[model samples]
Every structure is written in C-alpha cells, then in structure tokens.
Target chain A: MLIMKNINKIFQTADIQTHALRDFCLQVNEGDFVSVTGPSGSGKTTFLNIAGLLETFSNGEFLLDGEDVGKLNDNGRSRMRNEKIGFIFQGFNLIPDLNLYDNVDVPLRYRGFNAKERKFRIEQNLERVGLASRMKHLPSQLSGGQQQRVAIARALATDPRFLLADEPTGNLDSEMAQSVMSLLEDINQQGTTIIMVTHDAQLAQRAKRTIQVKDGKVSELENISRQHNQAIA
Target chain B: MLETGLILRALARNKIGALLIALQIALTMTIMVNAIFMIQDRQQQMQRKSGLDEKNSFYLTNTVFGQDYNIQAHLQTDLHTIRNTPGVVDAIQINAIPLSSSGWSMALQHEPGEDKDAVGTAIYMVDDHAINSMGLTLVAGANFQPEDVELRKEGQSTWPAKTIITQAFAENLYPDNWQSAVGKTVYISQTQPIQIIGIVAALQAPWNGWNGVERSMLVPFQRESKGSYYFIRTEAGRRDELMPIIEKTLAESDKKRIIRRVTTIEDTRERSYRQHNATNKILTTVVITLTLITGFGIVGLAIFSINRRTKQIGTRRALGATKGQIMRYFMMENFIISTFGIIIGCFGAVALNMWLVNTFNLSPISFQLVAFGVITLFIVGQLAVLYPARKAAMIAPATATRTI
Candidate 1:
C-alpha cells in the first residue's frame, strides 16, 4: 500500500527552476496493478521515482506500508527501497559484467541474505521468470525480452511488497511485450503490488487500474476493464 | 566473497586497463624497494663511528713555499708552540691524518718471500706521541717508546722496522689467531719486513670507500717535509676554541710555511661521506616522486573506469546497494589490482636486487623492505581509488531508468 499527498518535485538550475511534479496525489492499495501513462516530460517517471524512494520530493507527505518516507535519510531510504520495493527499468539495466545468476543475486546481496538463502531465492525467481536454465549467461548474450525477464527475477529476488516498473517492455517486440505483460499480471495476481509507467496505451490498459499524468499533475483515473475493451475495439 | 567475484568480473571486462594499472604498481614497488635499501645503507654508513676522538681533534696541512726554510726545525717549533698553547692537549706531526683522504698505503704479506699476493693496508707514519694525540686505545702490547721513534730525512733509503697494527688489520694478516699478530713480523714488500710491536683496538683509514677501511697500521717515525700534517687534540669541548689559536701559533712560528687547510676531524669525516649522503637524498626524492606518480595513475584509471560504468553502478544502486557498498565495490576492484601487482612485484624486486648484486655487488633486498613496499602500495591504491568510488556511490538510481 502507498499514499502520496500534494507531492512537489522541483529541478533547479543556475537561472531557472523547473517543476517536475506539483500537487500530485495518488493512492494504491495492496495487490493493485496500476499503470501510469503520460507524454514526455509529464513527470510520470518523477512520481514513480519518489514513490519508489529513489528520489526525494521537495515537498510531500508520502507513505508506504504506513511509514513516512519524507522523514527517512538517504541510508534509511535505501533500506526501505531494498526491503519493500523492486524496480524493473525500461532498459533492463542488468549489470553486463555479471551473469544472469549474479544479476538476480544483486538485490539479495544488498538484503544481507546468506549464501544459501540468496541461492535459493535467486534460483526460485529466475525459474519463475523461465530463465533458470540460463543462469550462467550474461545479459549481453540474451535478447531484450530475456534480459527483461532476468531484471524481473532480480527485482523479485528480494520478495519486495511492491514493484516499480518504468516501461518494462519498451524495447521488446509485440509478442515479447505481450508475454511480459502477462507475466506481470500473473505476478500481480500472486499478491505483489505493481505500479508500471508506460507510454503505450494498449500496455497501460492491461493493468487493473490506469492513471493519466499531464502537466506535472494526475488528470484521470479509471478502471482498466472498460479501457481494455475500448483499446481492443 | 560475492564482492570479490563482482570485482573480478568487472576487471575482466577491462583487462587492458587492469593490467596497465597492475604493471604500474609493480614498477613503482620495484623502484621503491631498491631505492629505500640504498638510502638505508647510506644512512647507516653516515651513522657509523669513525673510531677517533672526532669531537676534540683538528688537523692542519702545512705547505712550505720557500725553498731555504729548515722543514724539520719549523715542524719542531710549530709542534712545541702548539703544545704550549693554552687548550692544546697534545700535538704530533704525521704523514697523514685520519679521514683526510690523503695518506700512504702499501701491501703486507704474511711471509717475507711471498710475491704477487698481499693484503693492502693504510700506513700511518707518526711520532711516539701519535697514540696519545689521536686518543687511540692500545689494546695489546705497549706504546712506541721515545727511543723507538725514527726520524727519516729526505734521502732515507730504508723504512721503519717497528710498527703498530689495528686489531682489524691484525685479523686480516693472521685470520687464524689475531692476538698472535702482536709480535709477528709482516713484510711490507718482498724483502722489507717490519715487526708489529702493538695492536690498537680500532682505527679507520682515510679512504672509507673501500671494504678495507678498518685495516690500518701506525709506524714509529717522524715525517718532516714541506707537505706534512699536524694533528692536534684539545681538552674536552675545546677543539673549536683552539683551532684559530693553533693556526695563529703555527703561522707565527714560521712565516715561510702556509697552512693549506685547517679543519676538524668531524668536518673531514662529514666531507668524506658527502657523496654517499647525496646519493641517499637523490634516491629518497626518486622514491617519493615515483610513489606520487603511481598513486595519481591509479586515480586516473579508477576515474575512467567509473565513468564508463556509470549505468552499471546506477543499476546496482537501484537494486538496493547502499552508498557504502558501492564505494567498497570500487575500492575492492583497486585492491585486487594492487594485490596482483604486489605479488608480481615481489619477484620483480628480487630479480632487480639480483641484477644489482651481480652487476655492482650490492647487498640483497630484505624481506622487511619488500613487505613495506607492498603495504605502501596497498594504502596508496585504496586512497587513490577513494574519490572516484565515492562519486560512483553518489550516482542516483534514477539514472538507470533513463531511456537513453
């Protein structure tokens, strides 16, 4: 569960100040698969960053699982992010130098899991993403869809309460994107909360709920059942 | 263990960079070890005791400019006037002063008929007052008596028969039993045999550059000539006060002879070791400069690596790595490289020392100095990698999710 009240994010330069996000408010209950859609520079990623504890909001009252995120320092934020939030970036972002197993092992390592526990979690998650047979292969050796699956496995290795994904299928083909979307839906049905940011309306329609961002503000919120039917029509 | 694996994997991606840095570290360690050894040896040589009363003794070289002056009379008058001076403890005329770098040397043989093979030794021609004036300790036998003193004129054909040798020289002549050398006869040449009447505990020769510095002897003879030396010892803490006075007295005794140089024994010893000290200073400077350059090179490489891997670092950060973890990752990478270099440098250092030993006869490198070089490089590697690592740690995770 997460909540944000009147969040404001400002980017300052030498002679200009830009508002990345202003007066933004949103709430998602546990197990919700929410997709955020926005045009370029509409502050959708900024909202996701603040929600995931990766970036600080200049002015906000943000809460995740009933804890005030605004009061945590850098280290506390990192701990919160590690213990509760998993991230799937658009680029996959798997460390190229590390093999698939090591890529999935990253979050578990930061969580201070013992070797046995880390191995079990890494294998289980990689298997869940259908990549356990290729644990020794590096990210560069895999296709874009396979790399994304590895990234998902890496995010799930920590067993976080929520997943923050920014354009998770941005680089894949339609078939690969559909498979990744289905996998995310399956993960959501298993009770892991997921918030995805995407520009593709069809992909955004696959979520349980969809939020539209514009001019650094949320403009619309709708259940995706009707939107999904409308998108296919 | 996982961190190490990560470091190794990352380094494997940039093999050339890692190897370059490691080779730099190895070269630095090699130069550092050998230079430090040379400096330490030179410092030890400078600190060695010269085995003379350096604090209260001075030597003056007199060169007579006039041809008609009586050199022997002037020498006696100068010695008498110097002895009668207020602070003068004793004064004697000799052919050479200790540590003056101007002295007589000849080869000594164990038997009279031995040819082509002899132990080279410095010969000091001094009067009966030489032992007392130079504060030499007579460890065995007796000092030269007044009647034993032989005055050699300009046209003398034979050398002195009775001589006193140092303990070190005695050991060189008779290595089996040096104490037996006190009354033994040692031939200066094929037929010129001299009797060793006494043995002193220690006496260093004027030329300390060679390994035979400790092998020296004193002959009972008065050297009076235009180019002779006068060694004077004053009471404790009175040498500096008596130097100008001695020079004035000698000048007043005979105007025909000019004092070529007036200096303390301590000053002469310092002058003798000046080249050694200069070499030590130069080696120290080289070590420091090389260390700094090596450190900066590591920093530059780390910075370049970090810049190239910014996205990977950001990904790790987003995966929940703390800033400390990120910094430690970079530092661990540098540590691995430094360790590899140190391991190779150990062999390189020994090889360099072996070359030096075979080429110049230098002492072998010590294990302690090798350990010191390793530790120094380790510390410098870490320090050099620190700034770039901190920068890597500070990268925002949002950078990873950026579309580019």
Candidate 2:
C-alpha cells in the first residue's frame, strides 16, 4: 500500500550540508509486515517520515495508496495522512488532556464521523486492544504497555490503509515489548499492513522481512528463514 | 465550536495573563467614561444661557472731555452722537454691563415702607434706552424716559429720580408680584432714595458661569458719575463698519480713553465656552490615546499568545478544522476575554461618573454614554483578535508531527 523510489532528503545550512536520506527506497504491500533496523544516524526514520507524508522528500516519487504524495500541498498531505495512515510513535504520543477513548476517537473525528459512530468505533477498537475497561483512563494512569496498547487502539480506530510505527516498543520493558509485538503481529494476521522501525534485532527477526539501513542508504534486505538457512549452510 | 473550546481551554491555563489584560481593559474603560462625561459637562456649560442678548451688541468706553464737563452735558452729547450712527439701533451708558464679571454693588436697608433690610443689588446708572436696548423684558412699571432726565430738559432733579429693579431683587423682598415690588422705595445707601419705575427680569452676566444673581438696576446718569461704558447694538454683521464712525463721532479725547476690549458678541460667547471646555478637550485626547494603546497592546499580546499555542492549533487543524474555524477560535476567545472586562468596566465607569458628579460637581448623567462604552469595547475586541486569528488559521498541520 506504500511505495518510495530514489527518495532523497538533504538539510542545508549556510556553510554545512547534511544528507539525511539518499537513494532510499521502501515498499509495503497489503497484509505484509516489514521492519526497518538501523543505528541512531541511519536514514530509517527519514524513510519512514517520507513514506508517512510527515516530511517532504527532496527528490523522490512517493505513491501512497496509489496517489502521488509529492504533488500534494501541506493541506492535501495532511488530509491524505489523516485518511490513509496511522502513526504509532516511540513516545506513545497520545494527547495528555484526552481520555483513552477520546484519544482513539480523535482521528475518527477528523474523518468526519458523527458522535454515535465515533463512540462505537472507539469502544470496539479499545476492546480489540484489550483496553475496553480502561476507556476513560488517562495515559498517565496506564502502564507503559497499556499506553502502547492505547496508542495502537488509536492508530486502528481510524481504519487506516497502512500503519507506520516508529520504534513502537522503544520505551517498554521486555514483557511489555513482547506483548506489543504480539499484538502488532495479530493485527498483521488480520490483513493490515504494518511498517515498523526498530533497532532491536530480535524484534526485527520476527517480521516477515527486515531491512537494515546504514549511512543514509539501505545496507541489506533479508528474509528471516532464508538468511538462517544460508547461515547454517 | 470544538476549536473555540480548545482556545478557551488554553487561555484558561494562563489565568494571570488573562487577568492582566482584563484589568487593562477595565482601567481604560473607566478613563474613557470619565472623559465622555467631562465633554458632556463642557457642552452643557457652553450652551447655558447668559442672561443677555449678547448678539448685535458691542461695548465702547467713551469718555467725556474736560475735568468739569458736567455729567449731564457729557451724557447728552454722547447719546445724540451715538444714536445717529449709521448702524446704531439702541445704546445705553451704564456704570456696569450686565453679565460682565466687573460690576458695582450697594448695600441697602429697607426704608419705612419697604419689606427687607440689607439687600445688595448691582447698581447701574443707565439712560431710558438701556432697558429695551439690552432686550430686558419688563414684568412691571414703565421704563425711565429721556424726559425724566430733567437736567438736560428743564430743571429736573439730578440726585436720583427713579430706578429699575431686577426680578431677583423683586423675588427676594416681595416673594410674588413684581407690581407690588415696584412703586416701593429703595436707597442705594443712607443718602439716596430712588423710586422704582420698572421691574425687569433677571439678566445673566456674560462672563459669569451660572445664573441667579441680581444683574443690574438702571438709573439716569448723574453729574458726579464717572468712568462709565456705553453699550451699542449695531445691526448684526455690521459691528466692524460701525467702529470707525463711532470713533469719529465721539470726542477726540474720548477716543483715546476707549480702554475696553471690543469684538462680536458671538466671540464673547465662544470665549466663555472655550474656557469651560479646556479640561474636557484635554481629557478626551488622553482617553482616546490610552484606549488606542491598550487596543494595540491587546493585539500584540494576542499574537504572542497564539504563537505560543501553535502546536495546539496545528493539532486542531489536523483534526479537519477549516481555516475559518481556527480564526473563529482565536476571535471568540478574545471576545470572551474582552466581554468579561467590559462588563466589569461598566460597573467601574458607573462608580467613576458618580464619584465625579458627587466630588467634583461635574455634569449629570447622559443616556447615550452607555452606547459609547459598548462600542468602544467591541472595537477593541475585534482589532485585537483579527491578526492573531489569521495567524492561528494559517498554522499548518505539519507542525504537529514536527519537533515542537
């Protein structure tokens, strides 16, 4: 559901130029799960940003749900992002002032859903994430894992075409991370495309495919079992 | 609606800042209300009637020649020359002009037949024509005639023959009926007893701020009288033309003795009005300046406030709010803040106007003042909100995903 070809992002100051992304590429198909792994300064975050329409690429062609994202203005990009993409941030960036239910309902409201429909969708999403009983609780009132679940619930409530998760379990403990990863896998099993960026090799090994980025370029694209068999041979 | 609610919630977070703005609005409004009241007070002072028909009248200080000219001959010559001037309608030679700040007064005790003792009235030695020339209405006896000035005719008494009493004097002693007040006796001092020939309405002196004084009583000029002025009515718009002729007709010696100021009666009225309005004009300017500064201050602060909340605005924008919605959010937020201030300010204004009325003896309340207050507050609100709302509306949703 997402595609990027020869995407480049460069930051220029008066006397300094930094290449954030160069010759970067990414693709995610329907019902497929993909993980991108990199160190701190790699172009993985930049690729995810361009793919999700959060940042513009300097020289690139991005097709999101088959529409040319590079041609969209700020407002048009925002509209497409709201309608077609769900973001799960490493910080679990739920609005602190809102309760869990309203946090999940926010994107739905932007989609012009009425009050009754928004309530129903928010409750169903919260139930799907096993947080139905905590709908009225604040983010600060929940544990790290519960908050990530709320974030996931928020992402799925809008029924976006694809999910873009940037370090979804970066702040969680091992147990919480595994639960979030299992929940993400179940969502993928239910036929939703998820593109997650992480630095954890163990978590990257669980995805259908793992892409390693280094120095603003993709260093390796490996499948899970084939790489293991090749290592055994 | 949701956007506006969001703005209000943000404003509520900075309660102290909002309160400061409210206080500024209230204080400025108080100053505005007082300034308006002071202007109205000045207007009332300007329009208040001075008891004479100051229009068409001019004063000339004409002096008789010779140390021993004899008041009777001097008066006859001056009156005859002045009456024949081209634009001359009527003239009076008097010791004091009505409504002028300068005047002469005498304390009188009631004689055997009079009702009161020790009543003071302004004394003016006027000829027969001074009454009608000054446009004074007679409520009783006939005005003194030229024939009564027997010193110029035959052998008339020159000491004191008759006098006109002002209505205030009549009201003081008689309490009713100027007729009974007339035909009574009054003495300028212990020596002179003048019969009352006419009772005229009270005259307002032009320079006085208010009415209700015994203006002037008329009498024929006596030989002992000296240092008197003449009031002449030259047709409206013709005073300038009459000045040179009047100068030519008076004795050359008298011309040099014309020490008084002369101008149109309209100018005199405006002079009186100008004095009363000086404070009001100054107050108005100050109030207007302060209100404008406060309004711009509000605009500047609102811009700063919206800039600080850009992330919140971007989030709202990302939630499908239109530009118009964001604009209305800021505008409505400011309107609520201004409204609260205006309501409090109205009370403050009332208290201030009342204090001015009670302490300073300023002008009374006028009904139109409320409309001015409301309009000023609304204007402040709109001007303060316009640029801020526009800026808020222009904030892009991309800002939400970017590092705050």
The candidate maximizing TM-score is 1
Model 1 residue B341 CA deviation (Å) reads 0.8
Candidate 1 lDDT score at position B254: 74
lDDT for predicted candidate 1 compared with the true structure? 0.87
Proportion of native contacts kept per candidate: 0.69, 0.14
| lDDT for each residue of candidate 2 in B56-149, tens digit (9 for 90 to 100) | 7777665543465566666667777788777788877766665555676655555632444666667666677876666678888888877764
lDDT of 1 by residue, B1-404 (tens): 24887678767876998998899999989889988988887787677666678899999888889978887777778888888888888989888766677788877886777554689888888888888889888988878898888888875656788899899988888889888988888788666888999999888888877678888888888865668888999999999988998888778767787886899999999899989988888898999999999899999998998888888887787777889999998899999999999888888888998998889777888999999999999999999999999999999977777766
The TM-score values for the models, in the order shown, are 0.95, 0.70
Each model's DockQ? 0.64, 0.19
Tell how far residue A136 is off in model 1, in angstroms: 2.2
Q: lDDT score, residue B357, model 2? A: 83
Q: Estimate the lDDT of model 2.
A: 0.74
